[model samples]
Target: MTLKSIHIEDTDLQIEVKEVRKVSKIRYALKKLIYVPDADLKPKIITKILTHIRNIIENKVKEREEKDHEIGIFIAYKGKFIKGMVIAEDNPHYSSRNRRAASFGWLYAKDYEVCKELMEACESFARKRGKKLLRGPINFPKSVGGYGLQVEGFDEQLIYGVAFNDPKTAPSLKEFLEDLNYKQDSEYLSMEVTQDRWKSGTQLDKDIKIRYLTFEELNNRKDEILDILRGAFYSVLPDAFGMERYKEIMDLLRNIPSHYYKLPKKIKLENDSVQTEFVEAWKKCYDREVITFFHLAFDKNTDNLVGIITCLPDLYELWKDNPITRVNVDVAAVRKGYGRKGIFSSLNNIGQLTGNMLGITYYEGTSIWNLNEDAIRTILPHGRINRRFYVFQKRIKNPT
Candidate 1:
């Protein structure tokens, strides 16, 4: 794990995952990386990486873990490492789910020069890989730290640990990335909505049937959910699919309510295989009344699922040992032709009415990508935007 240093005059560049493959070497390299949270963090994140960053790389470096998971880029000035970025090299999914871009995430630097240096390192890595574009703040897997640069809603709570920057540092970071020609690839909104006004008022066509997707059904029907998700999402935002999955419980920390220090159940002392618990928990966690939010729409004529929306209790409430008073509407999808035909409304209305009856204070719709205008148009009127994010992109000059 000796450091692989690339000296660029006053700056020192070392990539944690570039060539180092030995497990011990990865640990050594990580321990030596920059840990200055104040320089990079935005409000409410509380330097989460200082404590959790090691886990991110450890899982990726394992012998059987995905190879393109993450490569840490550390920039040092005057013998002191100042900035760091995690570069997602190629992909972690099947090749057909692939996109020709690199993801830069866990971005943090003290100032413009350090930030510039960090970004240049990212472009260099992408170019070598022959990737056409570099885009991020997309920390791998969408479980830990998720995606986006916090461009708005600094005052709001850091719901489900989506990326947030130090308010003082975030604006400067945004200006710097924009100045560096990283165009906005996409934007996402985290919304807080009211539960009022939805009262089972719409009558559905007799040929269409709607019902809450029970845990039993979700357990048996993940393939159906994934199909509905991919078919519905591919056109609006394809790469976002890479950030999502339904094979198991998608994000653990977002699901399980902690009984102690809010310990995550996903962590294993040493295990390379995906645990059976994760798959079972996907259905088990939705067992409560909030399960009503897992709406499924089917063509009664053929009995084929055509639309869906899902949410879970905001376990952050329970992590704090508070009673569950809210749900975060996490994912929604309707197959291509059925998208605008009011399926989501019927689904959402049922959830809202259910929430209102249960006295859930508010429901959050998390991370809705801006490309889905139909979703934006449908959900925006009923809620106010609570948080906003951007994944900036820059076309790279690929030699290959």
Candidate 2:
């Protein structure tokens, strides 16, 4: 890209546009560094992911061209064209799952001021692009670019597609844009698995029978297992419950090597409205057994499923080679009024017992804002700490 113009004033700086393909080269380089040798990301796979990014940019460019709008990203500091962003039009469908994610690209900057200038340039370009809203630090949603801004925490390594920036970056960016009439848009929170405040309990072992579904039993009860999952987490993570999305998740889950461990085969819901597509999908994505480890709490008088704990093992490997196996407690629920009745306590005891049998010395459970801490405390006898992730936003209109 070629430089467009630069006007430096006493306090404010005016940046000109530029023509440079540095963004492409940077993305290509990052991919090469992170490629796992035996991983599924072969040449074709790499190309496809890159193609997705290209298509988004091309689509935005086409829209600007046809609409007679000016859509161009400017380099705030030409010395290094390090950051990039995709200008979007608007979000027509804003539901949690079907949100119309327009701008789905990454934005990086050396400092807060430079990022601010670039944001302005993008906004100016957006006006010509016929856009009515502005937001990011994200290229897309978490499923895509790991959406939002970094506010609370800055000193942490970012996940594959997640975004991170200096602590001052979000506040500075927010203030700058606010002064320019940008309104506060939204707030998001990122949490972590901590080990500070939790108090361990043995109730799980005392109350519930916890066991890995023996290879044979799991195979025969696939449908029932998924039903339990559907019933267990449908209320918490609603997105994963959608028929189509659930199928995708299930396909991913089925691919786990643990499926061969007599893990349950996913059962298809008999109702026409409830399809069995998630079964195959689970096989594609998950690398471990279906319902790697599960717990069922029962009343001494009645043998009914009252409380359950479902763990996903993909994250468990993060602590591979170490004695402790960090498992993401994907689903842990107890019927209302039963929470304090030692259901979770029993589940936790069973999980730890099963972990011990499998040679796993430790366990890690991920958490976020507004999650029930008491139940978690019942499981984690040890204390917990706080870890922060980015929560960013931009404005759709100038503030009053």
Q: lDDT (CA) for every model shown?
A: 0.58, 0.41
Using TM-score as the measure, which candidate wins?
1
lDDT of 2 by residue, 167-226 (tens): 544566556555655444444343343442223232333333333343455546545555
lDDT for 343 (candidate 2): 57
lDDT, candidate 1, at 271: 35
Give the clashing pairs for model 1.
1-25, 41-166, 42-165, 42-166, 43-165, 43-166
Q: How would you encode candidate 1's per-residue C-alpha lDDT over 1-400 as one tens digit per residue? A: 2223444555355422133334454344444442323332322232333323444456634544444545544433434333443444444542222465676776666556656766777787777766777888775444336578887888776455355566667788788899899987788898888545533225345456675544466657777777777655435463554333453244442354333112133543223332232223233333342244466778867778887877666545554557767777877787767654556666776556445444456778877888776677677887888889988888888546
The per-prediction tally of clashing pairs is 6, 49
Best by the lDDT measure: 1
Per-model TM-score on C-alpha atoms: 0.71, 0.50
TM-score of 1: 0.71
Q: RMSD in angstroms, candidate 1?
A: 9.7
